[model samples]
Target: MIEAIEIPTAAGTFDALACGAPGGREVLLLHGFPQSALEWEFQLTALGGGGCHVVAPDQRGYSPGVRPEPVADYRIEELIGDVAAIADALGWQRFDLVGHDWGAYVGWAAAAAMPARIRTLTAVSLPHPAAFLRAMTEDEDQAQRSQYFTLLRKPRVAERVLLADSGAGLRKIFDWKIAEDRIDDYVRRLTEPEALTAALNWYRAMHLSGPTGPVSVPTLYVWSTEDTTVGSTAAMATERYVTGPYRFEMLEEVSHWIPEQAPEELTGHLMRHLLAHRT
Candidate 1:
């Protein structure tokens, strides 16, 4: 069973969801933009059922008390620090990590910053930072796909565009594949005062920071063939950044919302990867 809880970090406290065996090895699941720990409901269930302790947090900007107004606060450094702090607060010297979308970016950052602390990493829907940057700079398809980032970087305009008509634009982004009630829940959480802005600050503060070097931890990267935002170039190039054991799974006809759309497949891959790397 998943339980709602508060996680204190040096930055602030975050609303989080936790599951699985109390004494099991730690697993940290991070969510992406416009999403909360709620997104990992299925993974929590599967991993928790499989005897791994899993915790998914609302992340910096999404959690009310932890939201920092300055865009600079949302920089990659602070974002990575938040993850480290979460680990420190949990008294976890090392943990397995998983992330989706922007969460995947943070996962990559964390693994790069301290590979020793992350026993395994499963990044869904995004490749490593250097690979993505190379794709964005040299691949026209990826560059075109990322144009939305430009709009999201605009502070007030993005707020108006996204929240317009009771979040019609934002709702459309999910393409109605997610249950209406679940989408409503996400919208409700984001529509809270200053919530949307805080979420968008992550995009506004985006910078690739060149190559993060190769990751040494056992890693798995799952990407969908239909992920419009991440093209073949970046997905295929991601393997170069991992010096340790690596696995790449591609889901045919799947969209970018892997955790929600392909929960079983994602869970299977995650379990296999984690179990294989277990010491």
Candidate 2:
């Protein structure tokens, strides 16, 4: 059974959903933009069923308690610290890490900043920061793909457009395969007062200035063939940044919503990669 609880960190407290053996080999799951710990419902159930301890937190601005007003509060450094502090609070000196979308970006930073503490990393849907930066500079396609980041950074405009007609604009971004009820749940969370903006600050205050070097820990980077947000250029370029064991799994015909739309397949990939690196 999934337990809903408050997790205290140095930054503040986060509402998290946890399952599995509390003392089993720990795994921390971080969700991405416009999503929450609820998005990992499947992974939490699957991994927890497999005798693993799992905690998925509604991160930073996503959690009402941890929301800070200033956009600067969402910068990469603070984001990294939140993940580290959350792990520390969980009494895990080191634990397996998994993240999707913006959470994947934070995972890359967390692994780089606290390599000794991140036993292994499974970064889904986003590539390493440096590779992404390089692609944005050199690849026209990737730059075009990333244009949405600019739109999302705008203040009142984004809120209105995304919330218009009960989040029709926001709903258009996802594939039709995602259940309508699931979309409704995500939309409701984003429409909460101050929630969407705080989440957007992650894109606005985004700077590639943190521990964004080559990762030295065992890692798995998963990308999708049909992901319109992250192009193949950066996805393939991700190999150069990992100094230790690395595995790249590409899901053909999969969209950006990998975990939600393709849960079973994604879980298999995560379990194989993480189990291989277990201490």
Candidate 3:
């Protein structure tokens, strides 16, 4: 069962969904842009039932209690700090980490900078930041795919377009594979006061392309054949940046929304990775 709870950290109080026995090896899941902890619904069930403790938090701006006003407050460093803060709040000395999309981007950077704090990492959709930066500059296909980043970073305009018509624009961004009720839930949460703007601030705060050290922690980077956001050039280059034990999973025909679309395949990979590396 998914347990909705609050984690009050130095950053602020973040609302979260948790599952599994409290004594099980701890795991924290980070959801990506335009979504919530609810996006991890499937993983919560699978991991929780499979004998692991898992928590997925409504991160940074998504949590009403933790929402900050300035875009500067949402920078990459701040986002990374929140991860540690959350762990501290949960009284977890170290735990496995899983992140998707923007969350994956943050996970890569955090694991690089704070290796001791993260036991293992499962990053979905996005590759290593260093590789991604190289791809954005050198790969025309990746550059083209990232065009939407421009719109999301636009102030006022992004909010107006995305929140208009009960989030028709937001709905358009999601694939048909996602259930309609879940989509509606996302729309309702984002449509709340200052929610959409704060969420978009993550994009405005910093470009995903940046300098990140080689990750030394054991990692599982899952890329999808059909994910238009991250091209194969960056995906292949990712191997160069992970120095420790690494696993690259290529999901055939799956889209960017791996957790929602291929939860079973993802959980299978995740469970094995976690089990193999457990303390």
Candidate 4:
């Protein structure tokens, strides 16, 4: 079973769901926006079965303890710092890392900034920030795919639209990927005004001034063919940014919600990657 606990970070305290055994090699799983640590339900069980400790956190804005009022507090640097703090709180000097969507973005930044602290990186659905920016500007398909981000950048409008009708707007975000029970949990967390704003702050403070160079750690980039949020151009370009051993896995007919939609395939990829590069 996964246990929820509060982890104190540099920015503040955040909630994390821990599974598997303690004192084993740590694997930190970071969930994306509008989601919590529950995103890694399958992987947590699988990895635990393999005697690996898994810690999946709600992240800064998503966790009630760490939500900051200022939008700037959610910058990439700050987000990375929060992950670092969580690692520190857990007494993990080095650990395997996995992230999805916005969590993947934070994972990239953290791995880049502190290479020694990360054993391997598995980023789901999103590419490196530089690769994403290049695609956003140079690829028309990527630009078209990212149009929803523009809508989300609007402060109150995005919140109201998502929270309207008892989170009907947010419920549609899950569509066919997430189960009804899971969607209900996301709705409950996001209904908190601060939680909603803190999640959106990630979009608001996204900037171009972070590390864009190649990642020095072993990495895995997972992409889905049918994902509406990322295009082929950006997905293909992700390989160029990794200087270390890298693997790319493309799932056919899957959407952006990979952990929920294709948990078996995702777990298979993760197991292979982890086994191939165990430290």
Candidate 1: worst-modelled 10 consecutive residues by lDDT: 205-214
lDDT tens digits, residues 25-143, model 1? 79999998777899999999888887888999999989997999988899888888999999888888999999999999899988988988999999999999889988999999999
Off by over 4 Å in 4: 208-211
lDDT tens string, model 2, 1-279? 999989987778999999998788899999997888988999999999899999999999999999999988998999888988888898888899999999999999889888999999999999999999999999999999999887898988988888899899889877575888888898899889999989888988875345488899999999999999999999999999999899999999999999998999999999999779887
Candidate number with the higher lDDT (1 or 2) = 2
RMSD of 1: 1.1
- Ranked candidates (lDDT, high to low): 3, 2, 1, 4
Q: Which candidate's lDDT is highest?
A: 3
lDDT on C-alpha atoms for all candidate structures: 0.90, 0.91, 0.92, 0.88
Instruction: Please identify model 1 stretches exceeding 4 Å from their true place.
Output: 208-211
lDDT score, candidate 1, position 226: 87
The Cα error of candidate 4 at residue 180, in Å, is 1.1
**RMSD, model 4, all Cα superposed?**
1.2
**In model 1, which residue pairs have backbone atoms overlapping below 3 Å?**
none
Task: Give the CA lDDT, 0 to 100, for residue 17 in model 1.
Answer: 96
TM-score of 3: 0.97
Flag the better candidate by lDDT, 2 or 3: 3
